[model samples]
Target: MKLKNIVISAVAALTLGSTLAEVGVGSKATVDAASINSTAQTYSYVGTSYLYKILKAAGITYNKFYKDNKITYRKGKPEGIVVHETADSGATAYNEAIFFNREWSNISAYVHAFVDDKQVIQMMTTKYGVWGAGAIANKRFIQVELAEVSTRAKFAKSVNNDAIYIARLLHQWNLKPNDAHYDGSGTIWSHYAVSKYLGGTDHTDPVGYFSKWGYTFSQFYQLIKYYYNLQGATTNTSSASSSSSKTSSSSKASSSSKASSSSKASSSSKTSASSSTSSNSTQAAKATVVKKTLKHNAYIYTSTGKRTKTLKRAGTTFTVTGTKTIKGRKYYHVGSNKYVVASNIDGTLRTLKHNAYVYDTVGFRKGTTVLKKGKRVRTYGGRVKIGKKYYYQTSVSTFVKAGNF
Candidate 1:
C-alpha cells in the first residue's frame, strides 16, 4: 500500500518545546507520534510502519535501483544520533544510494535513516552499523545523512527536519542525546574526530556544516551534557579514576629507583675513560712546523709561515707570505682575511669547483629556488640551491642540500 504524506506549513507552531525541556539541553527532544503528525509533515502507509512510511512519503523522488544495496541491523540500545549534511542534492534515489554506499565503506553499513527537505530515505536497518562515523565506533549510534538543497528556505527546512528526526530517534531508542566525536575524550564525537582515529582526515561532515549555521562546538557539548543528565546518566569526568592513584604512585617510584642506580654506575665508568683519553692525546704529538694550503671565503692560500691574515682579493688566488706547517690540514684566507679550510667546504655548492677560487655571494638565499626555471625546489631549515650557485643557510634561505651550504 502507498504511504500518505503529511505536509505541515512552514509557519506551524512548535508544540514540543516542553518535551524539549524534559530532555534537557543538548539532549534529544521527544515528540508524541500524534504531535509529529500534527505539527510536522508526516507520511503514512497502510502496510509500511510509521518510520518507513514517513521516509518513503517525503516529497523527494527516490531511485529504485542502485548498486551495492544492503541493509544491516544494529545490536544494542543506541546512544545518540549523529547528523550529517551531504553537500550533494538528492534528486534521484540512485545517486543518493551510491553516495551512501561509498561513505559507508570504512565502517559497517548501518545508517538509521536519510532525510532531505522533501523526503527521507532509509538505506540500512537501524539495528547495525551503517558504515557511518568513518572510524568511530557506531555500535550504539544512529547516523542520519541529510540532503542539502540549493535554496536558503530549503536549507532551513532541512535543518529543522534533521533536528526533529534526531529527536525522534532518541525517543525511540531511549538513548542519551550526547553525540560522540571520534576524538572526544569522554563521549561525543564528530566525523572529523573519528577519521583521525582511522588515520584519515578527509571526512569533515556534520560539525563543519552545522558550524555554518552558527552552531559552536561548546553548544554541541552543552546539548550532550543536557541529554546525558536527562537520561539519568552522569557525564564522564577525569577524576572518576582517582581511586587508583595509590597504586599508580607506588609503581612509578619503584621504576624510578631502579633507573637511578643504573645511571650512576654508567656515569662513573664514562668519567674515568674521559680523563685517560685527554692525557694520551697531549703526549702523542710533538710541536712540528709544517706548510699547508688553506681556503677561506672562496680564496686559495699557500702558507709559508705561521701567520693568519686575510688574503688579497686578486682574482681567485691569495698569496700567503707567512711561514706555517703543511702537517695535517691548513685553511686558506679568502677575500678579507677570512680563513677557511678545504675540508670545511660544502660539496653541494655547485659554484665551488676543485682548485677553483670561489666567493661568498649573499648571506642567504631568499624566496624559492627554481630549477631549469620549471621545477621549484622547496626551501626548508634556511637553505636553498639555484642552478650552479649555492646560497647560505639563513632565515631568508629557501632551499639547499644538507651539509652542502
Candidate 2:
C-alpha cells in the first residue's frame, strides 16, 4: 500500500535505451511470442498441486477471506500474473495479508496473493481485478507479492514456490510460460515492468529487491518458463534447437565445435542433412557463399539460434555460407544449417576455452537436455542469467552454474 517502500529508479537504469511507448493500464501490446522465444510445453509438476494445498492450509480463499475483508473484485478472468516484492524487508506473507486487510482507504492497494518460502496465501481472487498494479494493471492482471527472504537458500525456495504458483495460474488460463515473454505481449511482468510496459505507477519493486541478491528479470522469467513447460503434456526439446542466440566465440570454440559438427554431419549423414536444414524447411534457397573470413570468431549456432554449433576461428576463412533470419536478424548458415551472425565475422581466427557443453535451448528447463558435456561442447560468448543463477549458456539449454566454469 505504501509506494515509498518501493522505488522506480532501478527501472530507468535498466531500460536506458528502451523505446517502449507509454501504454495505459489494461492495454495489450500485440506481438508474436515466437519472435523472442519458442512456445513452451507442459509436464507434470509436483509443486503445481502442492501450492493449492499450502494456500488452503493458509486459509486463503476468495469467498471465505477476500470478499469478507471487503476487497473489491471485477467480473472477468485474469490475462496474466504480475510479480511484486514487498519492499518491506523480511515481510512474511501473513504480515502482508494483515496489512491488506487493514488498509481501509477509499482506494486501497491490494493483490491476489503473497508468497513465502513454505506457503502461498491468497489475498484475493484472480478472477477479479485487485488494486496492486495501479488502476490500469489492477483492472486486468492478477497481482502476486513475493515476501522477502532472509537468506539465499530461503530466497531460492520462496522464488521456486512462486514459480509453481504462477505456473498453475498460467495453466488455468490456458497459456504457456513463455507466452508471457511474447514480443510486447508477455503475460508475466514485474511491478517495474508494469509501470514501463503498462504505465500507471512508477514503482520498481521486485527487481530492486531481487537484484540485491543478484537475481534478475532474465532469471525470474526462466523459472516461470521452466515451470510453465511443466504443464505441457510432453517436452519440446526439439522446438528451439534451431534458433539464433547470443553472439558466438572466435577462438578454440570455433574449431572444436566445427570439428564436432563435422563428426555429427558425417555420422548422421541423411538425418544430419535434414536436421541441418534450417528449421524453416521452405526458407528461400541461398546462394553458396565461398570462403569468407571467419572474421569475428562469432558463435556458430543452429539457424534457429537455439543451439550453438561452436566458435569459428577469427582468421580462418572458411567457406562463406548461406544466409537466413529467425525473427529479423540475418545469419549465415554454413555447413548444413550451422549459423553465425552475418555481422559477427572477420578475416581472422584463434583459440579461447578448450571445451564446454552443448544444450538444447538457452533456458533452464529439462527439455534443454545436454547434448554433449566435458569435451566436444565448444561454447562461444558469455553467461546468461536464469532465475537468480548466472549460468554460462554453454550451448543451447546447456549451462554451467556461475562458479562451475
Alpha-carbon lDDT, every model: 0.33, 0.49
Q: How far is candidate 1 from the true structure (C-alpha RMSD, Å)?
A: 27.7
The CA lDDT at 299 in model 1 is 23
CA deviation > 4 Å runs, candidate 1: 1-75, 89-110, 135-140, 179-188, 197-201, 213-405
Kindly list the per-residue Cα lDDT of model 2 for residues 152-254, writing each as its tens digit: 6667667766776786678767755543322437778777767666777776567556655555555668767655553332212122222233323222212
State the local distance difference test value for candidate 1. 0.33
TM for every model, in the order presented, reads 0.34, 0.44
Model 2 superposed RMSD (Cα): 15.3
Q: Residue 59 deviation, candidate 2, in Å?
A: 11
Q: How close is candidate 1 to the true structure, as a TM-score?
A: 0.34
Q: Give me the runs in candidate 2 sitting further than 4 Å from their true place.
A: 1-75, 104-107, 179-184, 234-405
Cα lDDT tens digits, model 1, 1-405, are: 000111121111112111212112232322222222222221111011223344366654433222354323344555555555554543432345444444444333435566665545566555555445543445545667666566545554444444444544454466555545433442345444444443222455554444344343334444334222322211121232101111110000011111110100111100011111331121112222222211112223333223343221101222222211133333323333333332212111232112221111111222243233222222111122322343322111112332332
Tell how far residue 284 is off in model 2, in angstroms.
52
